[model samples]
Target chain A: MAGYSNDHIASLVRPDQVHRDVYEDPDLFDLEMDRIFGRSWVYVGHESQVPEPGDFFCTRVGLQPVVMSRHSDGTVYVVYNRCAHRGVKVVNEECGNVGRFMCMYHGWTYDTNGDLDFVTQSEGYPDLEFDKLEHGMGRVARWESHHGFVFANLSPDGPGLREWLGENSDFLDDVAVSAPDGEVEVTGGVHRYLYHGNWKMQVENLIDMYHPAYSHESSSAKGGQQFSRREGDKGGIQFFEKRGKVKSMDGLGTHALPNGHTWQGGLPPVENMSEDHRAYVALLEEKHGPNRTREILIKKRHNVIFYPNMAMQELNPHIRVIRPLAVDRTEIFIYPVKLKGAPEKMFRDQLINLNRTHSPTSLVQTDDVEAFTRAQEGMMTSGNEWVLLARTGPQESLESGRIRTTGTSEEGMRNHYRAWLEYMCADRPE
Target chain B: MTKNNRSGDNQSAFGELLFVREVEQFLFYEVGLLDDRRFEDWTDLFTEDGYYWAPAEINQPDPASGVSLFFDDVPMMRIRFARLRHPRVHSQIPPSRTSHSISNVTAKRSGTGDRVEVEARFQMLDYRPGHDQRAFGGKYEYVLSRGDGGRFRIASKKAVIINCDDVHLPVAVPF
Candidate 1:
């Protein structure tokens, strides 16, 4: 809105790199909230979050405050949080079951599917141009779910969630089908952090496997010591650290997909995975054949970026959502994913791993936070105008409708910016 | 008969007072060790099978199912301490400077004479080189037990942080 022309914006992004202003200029940031996030399919809460009728979870699509609610008829709705009367947010709380979202300002109530259920003084006001049916809660343009993960798009005319997801849908299927019953529930409260960096920094770091080796050296070293002991030697000392450690290019590769979704695969199996896999395979053998079960069990990938704002880690068992507060400040919400029909100990182990690796007090996240903060600081420098995305690789390879690169190549980041540039270059209203 | 009874009661009362004093001194010494960054000495204050926990949510009773800010037994604690001291732990590259102030201390005997339940409110000011100084206030719930040489050692320490459910800053060190 602050007067950056489309031609100038298009010039900022090249095939292999992006200009620094993409992360800095407040004008571009505001425009992005309108163009890219305003049109793209952004991840809403999971279906399991609002399992029962009338349950709701408050979240955001771009900078707009929205709520994902479940109706009595088993349908999910993503509605603008604003009340029809005074434009105030209808739901004040984070998440709970509510019969109706009654605006505190004037007591106007809207139903779970975001329909105006009641009015404070219906009889007092004459129905002129405004009708009760017309004044129902404002809804998002489109809402859809893939493998129980709901996504909302703010713009009315665009690709459906499936078309946009494209090849990335398989990665999501891998996560959901890994559950013995082909379902996952969002259990345990979300771990939220206010990061002092850009939202893209977090998204970029999702598949950036190169940084962990340097950033998390201390944690990996200590983990090695703890996991070096024999299994069952000490209670609660699983080879978690060893499983989480980054091995040197052990069958590692990155896959780039349409819509900027990229996945990093080939992580070494976590210790004791075979035992869990055997159990899962046995349970799923009746419904799914041994081959399918093997595929589900052996699908150990670190992370897959859903672009725009969300990333899901299959092995670590968590989904991370980024809410961009400002050009500089962002809030990261991490939710633990519980694979249904798996061993209860599996859920407990995943929770423990989250506590160890992702929590604010954890050694790994602390290092990441520090590095991101430093990156934010460095971006403000006048010395450099561009941030390099061209990592050393022998030209990206296109195989079977997917781009493949070395384990540590920056091709994934380049894929992200390409989609970003496309979205930002779209026609704007003003 | 009357004189012996009175004398015996007085000795028992004196012994209870001495136990409380020892518990207070032990807690204070532990705080000093943490402030001094003497992690090795700090960990030594715990009993062999003791626990160090900081519940992720308020009043989280157990760490088995729910996530925790910290839920470390001995080995995990060792890893945490070693990571803090490791050179490549970039988060602690400059290392955090902290001063812990604990007050409102209260100690009482639990089920048996060997165990004591101590509660204290604490405020810690932590500063890293570039980051702004942060004040973390919490309540410490400690279950202490008498170990060898009649010295009090922590059996469990649970740090309950106030107004920090959705933590924004890095809790790099123990609260």
Candidate 2:
């Protein structure tokens, strides 16, 4: 492999193309963990996951183990999961309420807010100057929350969470307001699946509307018709026209914002035949009134990619977290998002729909994973070194500093590569 | 809960033995349909309201509470099998060949009804042409009802695998 300098890395990504090595090289993958994921505001768990004091959730930011813990003062702290003493991983279980984090190796303990609380045999460390704050599990450089959705940045120097979020914040706002209680929570258990492909493949695929009609033909257009990925939905996305030609998603328009954020225009609506939807609408009307409720029901974005690590869909209301294990392996976790004050049946329907769409055995996502695996295999050919992202359509630059292009265009992905280059070429973060 | 089967004679010892053998045969035949790739016929063994559930959590009470690996009602099964049979199903281009084996079978009447609750352990070894062969094993809990011809029609079938919550690759075929 070539030693990737900033200039060489910049050369690899053109405005419309990228080299295959970025997805296949282990060295570059490690560099990205440090340069891109290491500096970005990677999403941790939601505020609801650690609702009570001492509640904790363990997860990864790039390859580093971190814990999101709720302290007695009602603050969430993102701290390194490693023991301050011997580098042993402090939290072993996925999540639990711990009164205090204690290292099993030598009995060093830290407070729920990650301050050093106790240390066994303090006399042994007399030769060394040990301060409580300096010696406790080091916190991430910065962390912030928007609508109870928490994100932590490993590097302190960067745009604040709100500035980085930009127009994407409105999407979360829409989600929160759609709920009768004006909030959302990550309630349902997670669905984790693995794919033998680069993490970028999954991120790129979510925004690539052009491939759906062809790639998902078997799942949606088997008999030149469509099937909703739910139990009792009245209709579904039609991949084929009545005359048997493929339908076009170009009207759905993809919006590209700053900081690698992109979202496709809402999918064509499928009327829900279930009574839960009616109850949900009624509750929203009770809270926000009829006219506002009508506006709230209109979904503006299909899937919102919070680049580098997470993507979310307002349609089914779920978040997908991308964890890269290697250059060729990635694990994805899908968590169902519950709109607060919605009908009980509505949340149940959400879980049921995720089973068909996001689960490992999902009728929809399995085909996607297949395409990703095949793309990984296909990129190994030595003939072509570049993967194309040249597709474009008539686009409008919005006042909000976003580009709106035909949904089928590759603008969303091209936008992602632009942000990718900026992060990869920046000087190493502290 | 329908009582369409042979009379109270099943209460006798030898008759119970005969009943167990019959259930074992039905299970063997049911899985044989899957091995032969007769999905349409396999689905026929279900009553109109019958469902197949593979929960992601241990002893998951219902599909509504959390995500499930699979929970297919008749309509869902139809769509799933239709996609599986589609000519360009890329995931199944080299179609998986599964050999399912079930043993340690037990069957008994529940709640003063002819409704037989059957339990068994199963291991399905699946192989696709150039991919790694995989084994999936779990305990099966089935609620059976007697339909026409006194044959067992599954009212509900639940398979709780040991690693139901483990991160898995794409699984096209049903377990």
Candidate 3:
């Protein structure tokens, strides 16, 4: 914004096309970190991640380090990871339990709720200069949670997390009710992969059903035959049509919700008769009754992107946090979601499936990473300046302001740019 | 070939050394198949119910307990290798070339059945055109059974990379 005006920023985004600078420019990347990630309800770690008081998990909101800790009063707090003195990062470990976060430099300490507790050599500093309340590890402007998922905002002016989540809230609710205990927990372990591409590439790919048939053909088909992704899967989603042409995934449908949220309709049902599956269904039946159980077992949605930072899939039951390292470097952390009170074997199967689908060596995702890295390098071409997103179909508008389109439609990516322009061009107090 | 002769003798010690050397040669050949990109042939070295596991977590109790980089059973291995052969496999366009090195080899005969438990340290240098070269090092644990004609087949091969928990780029090849 220093050299470019608001009009220049608006010029970068079109209704169906966006300038490659959105993915490649360092200047625009900085603006995104400030306007989009800085103001939005960026996802912090889940509540279940720090179940005990004083437990903390260090993560990043954009490029700045932040900590999410549970206080003794049972409240979860998101605060800057910087120390009150000298700006040193206070927490070095990924996640751990500590009574107080003591800065290694000069030994300043802070409470679990990020309140500055102790500072050594107090006599050397003027009491008037160092106010305790003003010097603690800085908390984010606002923090909130829905069903144990925590999101923190660096700005206080944006809509509340619920209002921002919009219709995606129903996606979360569907996930919760599908579980036996009517809850879900982020646990077991995380599977992570890094790609030499922009962070938004992963988010947009989540709802883009068109690419899978081409990008993931290796994993889904071989020697003119389609293979099941899971060992016991009856048949995976058909990538090739009966006439040897690539099948369009439009039938599954795609939804472009407000504020950049997007989701794809449920994947075709695959075969699984494992005891764990039966037992999980039985548990849901006992709670919701036989008729309601049938509805619960049917997946309501597949991949749901929560825009800018996070995405989750009900199919494999995991959340992928897209942490942008730089304009061109991004790290994606995938945490397997466990349905509370379901058979442990079901969770085990989920982990196994994710290993094959989401891990760095994942058969399915490796090709996706390949596409992303190539796109990052190819976008440097001055040959064609604009990256296209112009695919369309019969659009249906929902009462909640969400637009539904064909699964292969590029509406999802267009929706993201719509929100992107809104954020990048919005007036901010200097 | 009797248990009576396999106890506390110089001959038994010599026999154990010979067996370990034989297992090392077998391990070398198995890795060679991968290096040569004879992936389908690599599956032949596995037993009927054999598996290749690369645990994602350190000291992972079992494949079921935690996620793994790979947990391919024999059937999965066939499917994986078949995919690798697909010409349109974008991840394998330039095709990852790997040089595998095995060291610190140790082996012990199991008390029951004609099985040997082998552990070896391994490092693999993998490279694809226009991509950063990566080195993957790990400890390989194998439960190998001696089959007909005294052939050794892998019942299970677990490659526990030292940096298993670290974030990694797409690894198209097994370590």
Candidate 4:
């Protein structure tokens, strides 16, 4: 058995260095489920998804299957989606409006709040001493919302949602509150995708602006028609082909704010876009007015990988949920949000854009999927013992609970590795 | 005998005019266009304002408020077709080949003109280089309109996938 001492694991994580086994280890994955995912605030689903009283949506928090339901009193509840009797999953469907959830196996019924309401054979269990109050569905330790997005933390003693979010809350507010009505609703339905890579790889890829110009070259080259001429004419291919050549792909650099928040700015500048994009901008201004609309639209961001599992992109209006199934398999759920009060045509336009570009059927997304899958397969080989995070080294700056590096630096990856090491090495709290 | 003959003749004539066989053939041709990657030709078949929609849920409309898997208009469709055929688009190096089949054509007359509504069941086998072929089966709802020169423009094309909500890999090509 490969046993790791606490000191040994902690010593492996330096500000700029980390062990490769952290990404490949099975024990570390389980430990993470307990330490990081088990304690941190994980996003569930948006409240608008379960607007109605009896509406419910099933999701996974770490490895635990959870159900977020709206009670008759209008309060939302997050409970384990398992039947107390035999641990059978109570809700199997993605979403539905059920007055009460009844276990099909044993006929045990629970109300929308996960309160046990009825049992099939009450008299048969005379001496079982099953208290409905005690046996109510196991609720998450903490459930809260920030701008209509619901999140739950598995640890009851951990930080509050706002405290946990810290400075990053501002970015969340910017995304949610900058809308015209100062509110945004989930317009497009959720789109889920799977990836055959380590969950961390997906998270790291989100802020790693370096890969898009290369990984998404095919997508940008074809889909980015207006920019094609500029990229082609911009001297040698090396200038345009570098990983972070495009301004939009600059997240790979070490530019980030306090509270572990970081983002790449601006879109790939394409010809004729200065005018054509203005039309889209005018539409946004019409909806959100010039000021707030400018705040939401003008800020260019490709992806914001919230530590642990959520990857959000304002440009795409989609939030992706990362669920690590195994060391090699990760499930990604993509939920597309529509700005409330926006024109129907605008939504249609976004849908078409995403479907043509991001959908599994899209040319851009497939290349990314293939690359990640291949990377996972390759890591299984014995040739490479460790993955490298030693990109910028001594140049990285650590300050105010955030790690920063050059705009083209790999400091974000180093930060994540540091956090991962902490989670893996920390002793289990008694 | 003359009156009875006239009634039977009218019934047969109207049935022939419905042209269910011709409608079926039209549907098959439409599927063939997509399967063969005749995207530009497919674009030619749509009216200027024609749309393609796939609901995220079973019966949710109003794509603005409710989520939709796809809701594309003419310009959007054109852009998609362009991307699919782009040379540098890496995902299409070993382009996806799809085989689709359509069945069950039903036509009825609406208020102004004849409206044809048909249900098409399709099983698409998508193959790419180094990746195992994936199979997806779904039902499609097409609303066709009679355009100029006896051509047909699709008013609406909705595909209801069986696994709409499942975590899927990036879908690069059009389904």
- Estimated TM-score per prediction? 0.92, 0.95, 0.96, 0.83
Clashes of each: 0, 0, 0, 20
Q: Isolated chain A: TM-score per model?
A: 0.91, 0.97, 0.97, 0.85
lDDT of 2 by residue, B97-131 (tens): 99999999999988766688999999988898868
Report clash pairs, candidate 2.
none
The regions of model 2 sitting more than 4 angstroms off are: A1-3, A222-225, A230-232, A269-273, B1-11
lDDT of 1 by residue, A310-377 (tens): 99887558999989988888888889998899877767767877877778887577788887788888
Model 1 stretches astray by more than 4 angstroms: A127-133, A221-251, A271-278, A395-400, B1-18
Which sections of candidate 4 miss by over 4 Å? A1-27, A222-261, A266-302, A338-352, A393-399, B1-18, B62-65, B108-115, B145-155
B1-175, model 3: which lDDT tens digit per residue?
6676655576878888888899999999999999999888899999999999998888788888777888988887887787788878898899999999999999988878588999999999999989889999989999999887999999999999999988899988788
lDDT of 4 by residue, A79-134 (tens): 99988888889988878999999988988999998888787877998787777656
Instruction: Give a tens-digit lDDT track for model 2, residues A179-232.
Output: 889999898788989999999999999998888777777767737235665535
lDDT-better candidate, 1 vs 4: 1
What would the TM-score be for candidate 4 when compared with the true structure? 0.83
Tell me the tens digit of each residue's lDDT in model 4 across B1-175.
6999999999987886666676677777877898888888887777788887765566665555444555677776776677666676565667777777665556654657556676767666777777678776677877888888766678888787776655666554445
TM-score of chain A of 4: 0.85
Which whole-number lDDT from 0 to 100 does residue A429 have in model 3?
50
